[model samples]
Target: MADSLATWMPPLASLDDALLRYLDQTGVAVLVKDLTSGRFTAASPCAPRVLVASQDIVGQTDAELFDAVQAVALRAADQQAVALGTAYAGEHRIERHGERREYVVWRHPVPASGEQGPRILSCWQDVTEQRKRDVLVQATLAQLEEQQKANAELRREMQDNQVRDSVSGLYHRAHFEEQLRREADLSSREQREFAIVSVSIDGMDQIRETYGADSCERVVEALGRLLKANTRAMDSPCRLGGDRFTVLLSGVGLATAHSRMEHLRKACSQHIVAFNGQQIPFTVSMGVASFPHTAGSVEELMRSADRAMAASRAKGGNHLTLASIQFVPAT
Candidate 1:
């Protein structure tokens, strides 16, 4: 293709080594032409791929490179670019080897003097593959959006499970377990005692049957409020699932634990949870245990508190009891 234009173009002029290197290395087709002389000067190696203009294109004018109609249109565009003294670019469709393809072309005017006359530098980029890639990008973007939404939902569920109870806004069982371990370690290291009080709503199965599901939710909320109101700042309160709550009272003895839990029970009994225009009355049973007094280890403390709570519930609902477990070593 370049061989054809070699004849129509003028004799090659002195060219810049860097410009030739740039054209050779670049992916697109580049060319230099003297508009005033109506002749081609230089072409990048990709000239054969992009320029199907004319094979016999050495000293020939634009009129010679293309047919009459195309020659006329190209000349008009060139004139406009030269007038602006800047690159004029646009997408163009042309037939090559019996196939029509799209190319983005730029015509930049280069000011020249003497015999060099006014020059035009040009390049053409094939955008067929680029269009295909753009479509794929849109599909990839949609897939990424879906993945992000799924990840967000997974994060929310994980957060709900780890730190908070979905219904009551209290610390859940996992948090309580972790806090218990930390508190036990701190108590042992400081040679101090902390109380573990286990509390559970009395006769929950009966209450749920009598008042329905929402009633249970309301009762739990009211109970959470009561715990918050009665417990001190250092206490760690948690919901250990299904109407059961436990508190780790830092630096508190068995007597203080009993007083606090007894006060909490009275408040819980007096407070009525209102739901759907009905006043729902509920009560809780509490069991208290202390480190090194009632139990030796975290497991022992939890078991002792649970046992005491169970005893309170067995006797009747809504009572607080102390579990007396003297720490004894094996013989």
Candidate 2:
């Protein structure tokens, strides 16, 4: 059987002149489709213009005008709209003259008069440029968010580098002091106790004299690595210059703090510094002081820990000492 719509349509002389003229002059594209035959019965002059085609579109099905995939989509929508006797509205993409275009289209189904069969009234508006602009805007927004995230990460890295020691990769003296003051304030306000452990290498001066400056520096670096390895994530480890190190253990007592430092001391005693083919032995004395148990203020706590560490070093090198609390008048 013939598939051409002209074979189903009446003679060209029977067309309504007023309607044809009106459609020719109208800028909007409109079409009437025979739902039973699945072919266009009539198309306005503007319909051909919208498709960038100079030939008449009356006999052309979507399969002739578009690729197979696009035709299948359009046919499905048209069939459903006609079956339901309702309006269809959607976006459709098609390739024309080797370029892709988007359209906002609507199809309205209506019963045909007498022998004309079922009909579909369809119209489309070009929306290709608008969709392209929307895509570009979304891409730009995503790039901006990524850039902001990178900037935030860079700022955090720079701040960390500023407060880290070059030799030990531990907190610098100023950063350690800042943390000390913050912990002291927290402890006072909450009436909770926290511990601070001070560490010093025993006979460091004698080791420097015997091993030379290079060996002494290496020993300091080694101790810094050991301390960092032994401390917990919540603990703040700091190198306070020379052979001195400190750890601020938040929410811990003198006993637990002393236990942790004793393990570190044991590690240090077993650690060997091999230089110039000679094994050099080293050990650290640690002093533990708690906020309410040892002193009230940061300055007093530091002094007590320092005095205890000095006492331990004087007595024997590899020992841990607990500081006795000193009374001070409330300010």
Error of 1 at 31 (Å): 62
Candidate 2 per-residue lDDT over residues 1-331, each given as its tens digit: 1223233344333445565556446545667778887778777656777767656677777787788999999998888887777888878888888889888778888676667777787876677878999999999999999999999999988998898776777888898899888888888889888999899888888888898877887777788888888888777899898888888988888888888888899999999998887777899998889998898778888888998898898888798889996667799
How far residue 237's Cα lies from its native spot in candidate 1, in Å, is 1.0
The models' CA-based lDDT, in order, is 0.80, 0.81
Q: Which residue ranges in model 1 land beyond 4 Å of their true spot?
A: 1-162, 327-331
Candidate 1 to native Cα RMSD, angstroms:
9.3
Give the Å shift of residue 113 in candidate 1: 64
lDDT of 2 at 115: 74
* Superposed Cα deviation of residue 46, candidate 2 (Å): 4.6
Model 2: worst 10 consecutive residues (lDDT sum): 1-10
